[model samples]
Target: MKADAFPYRAPWWLPGGNAQTLWAALASRRHFGPAPRWQRSRWNTPDGDFVDVDQALHPSAPDAPLLVLFHGLEGSSASQYAVAFADFAAAHGLAYAVPHFRGCSGELNHAPRAYHSGDFAEIDWILRRFASEHPGRPLLAVGVSLGGNALMRWAGELGDAAAQQVRAIASVCSPLDLAAGGHAIGRGFNRLVYTRMFMRSMVPKALKKLEQHPGLFDREALLGARDLYEFDNLFTAPLHGFRDTADYWSRASAKPVLHRIRVPALALNARNDPFVPANSLPTAQDAGTHVTLWQPAQGGHVGFPVSHGPFGLPGHVRAMPEAVGHWLLTHL
Candidate 1:
């Protein structure tokens, strides 16, 4: 109903903001259920390039709720959150599908265009397409980080005219203010560690993409980008038709439009999220009537860690799934 602390507590063991942020991404904890079976499918965009989808079908309910998930930057079906949530949905008798960003599905996308934080076109297409294919099933969406930003932008852009077929929306650890997020990740050790981690995977892809459109981008200057802003400036903005990085972050951010969302959308951000500062988050008044902003005190970037059972079996990994499952139980 309003922006509030989402009944989640960070365990004492997961000290510091960055620790919570990195633990889930780095921890090798095993999932505690039968593995989900996925069908790999491709959706050809209006353009020639195609995006990929990994669908986790519901075992017994064809008309069950369908959860369409979008992963964060450089994330695909293999992302921890994606796999966890897909398993959660499937086990709950819900069908789930994960749509990979333009080039993240282990394949280079068509040229002159790539995925960005504000790419609502593809998300809109996914929602509409799923609703058409399923006919009467309820629809929901969950986006993490970059995907979260894109989901919020799409819902806000749609406003009251937003698709009624879509019943609810949830965004986890998204940087609604793209500029703020960019600033956060650009400074200090975050810049040193996170930026490099992103670029390690990103640079090679850009290099590979450049092979398709040789001489289109600066051969050396583009290759020398040291941070997210530089990367966006050299590649994302120009390739996707933005004026520059600043313009791209400004126009692509979802904060300014949060008030326009018409559906019961939830924005979950860890106040201590390493990538998005607490000040950048919205309050209930700022988010308008349609959106709920949940600011948990200590979830790192995409990490929401709770205590483990006496045996420390699943650890805090279950926190996110529990929260999401509870929210959906009430919302649906």
Candidate 2:
């Protein structure tokens, strides 16, 4: 599909153009072929927990700006999006790091509380430690979907306090408005597909967490959940100490913090994204001077695939590491 044909470019409240290119790229879901080589490492957080991370070095350069990558919900180091971005980083002589959220690195986390969308503290802890260890090395971040929300929240919260070693940030397909996104996903066929996929991953983890801590979750409420909102309301919201789903969504939504972002950052979203609508984007007035909101016309969620000859590639995923790498090389 032609990127210009996307609905986001129709002079809507949310501007399009670049965002449309990103959306078309994501919707293609093109695979980048083989996975790149990476070394597995672990970092000890301030809380005495070890988070698994995959560090991939650029094939050409030994020392380069580090791109800290974050995957979407239930995505890990093995995810196609993660690997594709890592490959792009490698191609650009940019080292990348993929931090596996708790219970996502092929192993259950020691804590009962799993990772969530608004967990900025964890990213902060990781970045601080990485900076301390790497010292003067330049660092940037790129988050996908849920990971995008986390990074955005962190960037907004960091403001001037964000480490100087850090350079720029890029977020793709993030649901900035958690409440609206959640509401959208709970209706129609979208609900069926999303709920099934999410629960396939979530329910198992929830069950495991429940087994680990018997009284942690309400079994009845969990079993009765018919949608993502109901599931989060029953489990995620209560587990994190929110009043309910509304409170959790309100607090976790990144829209309230976009204007506060002080660092150079790029946010990409699709107008036709089944998960997040164009309305969820931050207004030009609301977005700080440092933030560049790229609302593409066609990328569906994190699925950006562009076929080239017999080999197609997801444009958004492919462009992400390069975009950040080039941005950091030029700006930072």
Candidate 3:
């Protein structure tokens, strides 16, 4: 989508990337509508492991379009963006499901491996299963942050065949270029804030995975890791069958394969996103005809706040999801 056509405008009170991002994470929940009642289902993966998918409870006609949301790293169905989309899906009479990436649904996964930005194979099977169950119902998908990159990678890898499983897809604040994102998140304020925030949960989970499978990786190396690159080198790369962090980031990035997407897809990124540098984003020509690029001037990471509350309180973070969800629904 063209920049002018995009609907997000960062509120004056929520100026810059950091403020908007922090508010969306910490305060946006209160501004959203009623929390969605969820029914959780466990699906055993083909690999002898299982993933839990949370379906939002909403009264809608049978065979209504199913909206599958893939949450970001360490994010689940209850994430701020996921909950907001659940509200949007309910209002539009759509079926909504958020599939938790392995080990993210609360219970530690049985498998030694965990989710990553380029986990397209995992995305492929999960989406395929959803399609098989839904049958003729229209299937629409939205991926937030890391989930977005994985979903797009799945699309690009399948090319024309992706249309069979999903009608349309949208990604919000995804770091399509994994190498750039990895480097960006490793330095300065981003390293101190966002990287540590993610590592706080990630490191502990990885250590637990080691306990599940002895000698999976070096415990000292994992413990000594300070940034995403070091962490991935110790855990994410080897377990997932990559040479190292360099190999993983280069091979996992969706930007290189975006032009291969055959179905209608939207790749929305904020120019100000701290995790994803503006220079690393793909252009319209780079993404090809089937993809729509929305690089707005603001909206940090997955945070897009439109309206400030009474007396200049925190802004409401529903505009991005509403706009993106509408776009998905329109294609259906």
Candidate 4:
């Protein structure tokens, strides 16, 4: 789909990227209405770890399309965007599920390894399990931020094989170019605000991981790390088997493998997204014929707050998900 055809316009009341991004976290829930009920299930991983998944409580037809959401860093099923998408799926008579990455789900994972942006093996396992369980049901997947990059990597790695597992996929505000995004988030106001916000939870999680497996990484270095780059250097890189921050960012990036995706895929990003640099976003040529790029001038890292509706009235954060969800359905 074309970028302008996306039908998302930032509200005058919610100006700029930061405001839109923060509004989704702080206020979009109120406007989007109450969150839908969720049913939690724990799945055992092949490596003896457990991951929790939250499925929307609303019932759909037995053959209804299943929408699986892989959330951003430090995000869960209860996240504002996840709840909003649940509501959207319910409204459209679709089944929805949100799978939490290790360490992000309330409880820290037992294994010393943690999830990362290039954790496509984990994504492959999760999606394949979902496909197997649902048999003939059509499956659709959407990954937000970190999850998106991983999901895309999985699709690219598997190539045409992915077409059998999922009908379509969408990535919202994902940092496709991890190197660009990693350095961007560690500098300027992004470091002060967004990076700090993520580190608060991440550092504690890493500390807990250290406690689980003593001497996993340096204690003082982990504590002293100021930004994601430093934090990854101290903790994430070693735990996930990367040599260092540089190696992790480069290899984990989804940009280089975009051309390998054989299934229909949508990569949506805002030019002004605080986390993903505009220059790093993929074009049609970069992503290949099967992938579509939607680089709106606004939306702010999965925060697309609309000002006007079709009736010329107020709009909410549901606009982006609804549009993306419709796009996914159309591909099916």
Q: In TM-score terms, which candidate is top? A: 3
Which residue pairs show collisions in model 4?
none
lDDT of each: 0.83, 0.73, 0.90, 0.88
List, residue by residue over 25-117, the lDDT tens digit for candidate 3. Answer: 888643255779999999999889999999988887788999999999999987889888898888888999999999999999998888888
Candidate 2 structure quality by residue, lDDT tens digits, 99-135: 9988889887766678888888888888887787766
In terms of lDDT, the best-performing candidate is 3
lDDT of 1 by residue, 1-332 (tens): 47464766666778778987787777724245666677989888777788888897547486788888899999988887887786678668788888889899988888567799999887888888888888867888889999999999999998876657588888999999999999999999899999999999988888888888887688698778999999999998998789999999999999899999988788899888889989988877779988877887887888775556785524546568657655755666
Clash count per candidate? 0, 20, 0, 0
Indicate the TM-score of model 2: 0.86
Provide the TM-score for each candidate, comma-separated: 0.95, 0.86, 0.97, 0.96
Q: Candidate 2 at residue 284, lDDT?
A: 70
| Model 3 misplacement above 4 A | 1-4, 30-32
Q: List runs of model 1 lying over 4 Å from the truth.
A: 28-30, 309-314
Best-to-worst order by TM-score is 3, 4, 1, 2
Q: Give one digit per residue, the lDDT tens place, for model 4 in 160-205.
A: 9999899999999999999999999989999999999999989989
Error of 4 at 280 (Å): 1.0
